[model samples]
Target: MIRAYAALEKGGELKPFEYDPKPLGSEDVEIDVEYCGICHSDLSMLHNDWGMTQYPFVPGHEVVGKIADVGSAVKKLQVGQRVGLGWYSRSCMTCEWCMSGNHNLCATAEGTIVGRYGGFADKVRAHEAWVAPLPDAMQPVSAGPLFCGGITVFNPIVQFDVKPTDRVGVIGIGGLGHMALRFLHAWGCDVSAFSSSADKEPEAREMGANHFINSRDPNALKSVEGSFDLILSTVNADLDWSTYIACLRPKGRLHFVGVVPNPISTEIFPLIMAQRSISGSPLGSPATVTQMLDFATRHQIEPIIETFSFDQVNEALEHLRSGKARYRIVLKH
Candidate 1:
């Protein structure tokens, strides 16, 4: 039996719950969750914002833990290895995308909290392919967010071949954006941070931003036009995206890792005239995640996180709801 805190209904309070897990398959492994990160996506699912959440939901996907059990077919991971699991719990290994090493793009990928219990409990289970071993130098407590938020931003840098000499701009200096600033800085790019909050400038610079742009100021946005090689937007709120597009150099790209509620509105002429591009990506493949962890370890880059005990899950949720989390929230088991 797996013991966990679960919401009984849509937007309901979480209560203690237990259920018998199915027989562990030959390819599955059970993780003794040490720490889990609370993501905004968890809150959205808790309230059924995307309309696919199931009741008795246990919301956690940014998991850092040790393997407590491993199926016979799992050869790479052992019973005591430290590992992390992200948004995906499983993907059909036979798919063309999976075969080509783009497992995150698999059509039938399984979300950790979509229809299954997640890492909010003492234990969670996932296929070996979705489990990534943690590097020895990486601290497990602060490593949870890297599996989701970290990889979300890092994947684009790798996929788009962002050069070290490129000028990069990050929008929204929050959970996802802050991490982007750190990684891009370590990658040797000239990093810029764009935020509506003027107060974030100092922290953004400390996080590795070379310049800070007040996103709310029209003149500030205009001054950087035709400057950036890439702009990574990590905010969920919709904005006048055309202005951001205008900031890009010819052949530059505006990428998104954030989930904007509305369809994006932008001018096509800028893209056509300048050869600029607009794109977005989900959490990265396991291989890319491993690479990100190694890079983070080398650069000493970790998420700015606030810790909470699993028992304080509700309070932590409310704190995140109130928008007071310094950057990311982690739950200790």
Candidate 2:
């Protein structure tokens, strides 16, 4: 087995050390990681926030790597091809979600963190069936976040059949929100960026948003009432759905992709009043991931990221957790 450096979760802290590679199965491909994106879910998993977590966890799902070696059964991928692996690394292919092309929710869905060792290291093994080919338009390190942040935002936009002229509102201007703005703007929509912080206005506008609204102001809420065709929420903050619901025009759809650990205390009255619908989406289907890459390549759309070395993972995570990253953070080998 090859030895690579990995940052492990030890006593609630990540410490760097050597780890061994497991024997490759016929369906597995060994990858030499070029970049790994730090995800918010990694922090949640590291702390056992969702409860089922294994220790010594190597937490990263947004991985971009090169095929260093492949097992005999693998035919579709060749050595040296650049590829990206996302949150869902494996799945039970016969489930309803799989049959419907929504592999992100397969009940036995295998997250990169949950099953195999993740990409927070120099080398990783991934399922050949789950890796996506990188388009020529994206740089390897620059593309890591696309597997998570890009696919997460683009899937809901596609599932909703967002149109060119649709009036779109994106809440929360962090990593997901910034990417949402990029996608929505590129889709030819009238995009409005929402944030509770007034300081986010300049960067929000630079990301191609036509309007920037500070949701804390009562006047701002009044002007936005019934003004949106769709609202894609990317914030983890506790929300008063009534306020957001009022911002939607009749028959509008609101999709929430963020996770707030607290149960959403939303009232159902607005659902009946305006026939509005609320839904949640996980990362994209394997098929949709390919489509998103194609779109990103064609439109010259890419995420802005700060790069860190493999050993500096802790600093990167701290930056992300402390809300200092401009948009996304990635680690390079």
Candidate 3:
């Protein structure tokens, strides 16, 4: 067995330490991690908030690594290949969702957070089907955030046909929101950033937001009513949908990738009057993940991130929880 170094969340909070690697299975490929993005989802899993967390859980899903070994039957990947893995670490390939090509929504779709150990360690084991070949030219640390944060926001951006000329509004300027702004701006969309913080205005502009809407200002929101062709809301806080919907153009699409711990409350006018749609998506299917990577490579689009050494994982998580990181936090092995 390969020895790997990692910090452990020993059924409560994360404490820096080491752990042993599990025996590799035939369908698994062993990876020596170069970088792992510290997603807010990781923070969610650390507390066992969703209630299925395994103890000594190493929380990470946005992973980039080098393939150190592959099972004999593995054909899709080879040893020494640069690779990336996202939220999905495993799924029943013959299941209905898999057959219907919507594995992301599968009832039994096992995640890196549950069924398998994730990339919080120096090495990880995962099925070949769940791993995507990372572009050799892409830097590992920067690419880690793309696996989850980039793809979470990017999948809908591509799926819903929000194009270069569309007026796109991104809500919240934190991890996911920041990436959404960059991706939309890079796509040549007329990007607008919505946030409560006045301080994020300059940073938002620097990240390619053409306009910054301070939600604290009524006039700011008033001017943008029915202005956006698409709105990607990334705030996890329970917010009034009417306020968000007011920013959308007629029949505009609102795609949600963030989770609110509480149920949302909103007026019916936004949906009933405008014919606007509200929707949510899980992370990308394995196929779409690769497509996102290729598209990002072609467009030179990557997330802005702060990197931390593996031992400093606790500090990394604290920074993310405090909302102090630029956009994304990555851990290097």
Best by TM-score: 1
Looking at model 2, which ten-residue stretch has the lowest summed lDDT? 2-11
Steric clashes per prediction: 0, 0, 0
Predicted structure 2, TM vs. truth = 0.95
182-279, model 3: which lDDT tens digit per residue? Answer: 78888899999999999989999988899999988988899999898888889888777778788888999777888887876677777888888888
How many backbone clashes can be found in candidate 3? 0
Local distance difference test, candidate 2: 0.85
- Which lDDT value does model 2 have at 285? 88
In the order shown, the candidates' Cα RMSDs to the true structure are 0.7, 1.6, 2.0
After superposition, candidate 1 runs with Cα above 4 Å error = none
lDDT of 1 by residue, 27-49 (tens): 99999999999999999999999
- Segments in model 2 whose C-alpha atoms lie over 4 Å from true places: 2-11
Window of ten residues with lowest summed lDDT in model 3: 2-11
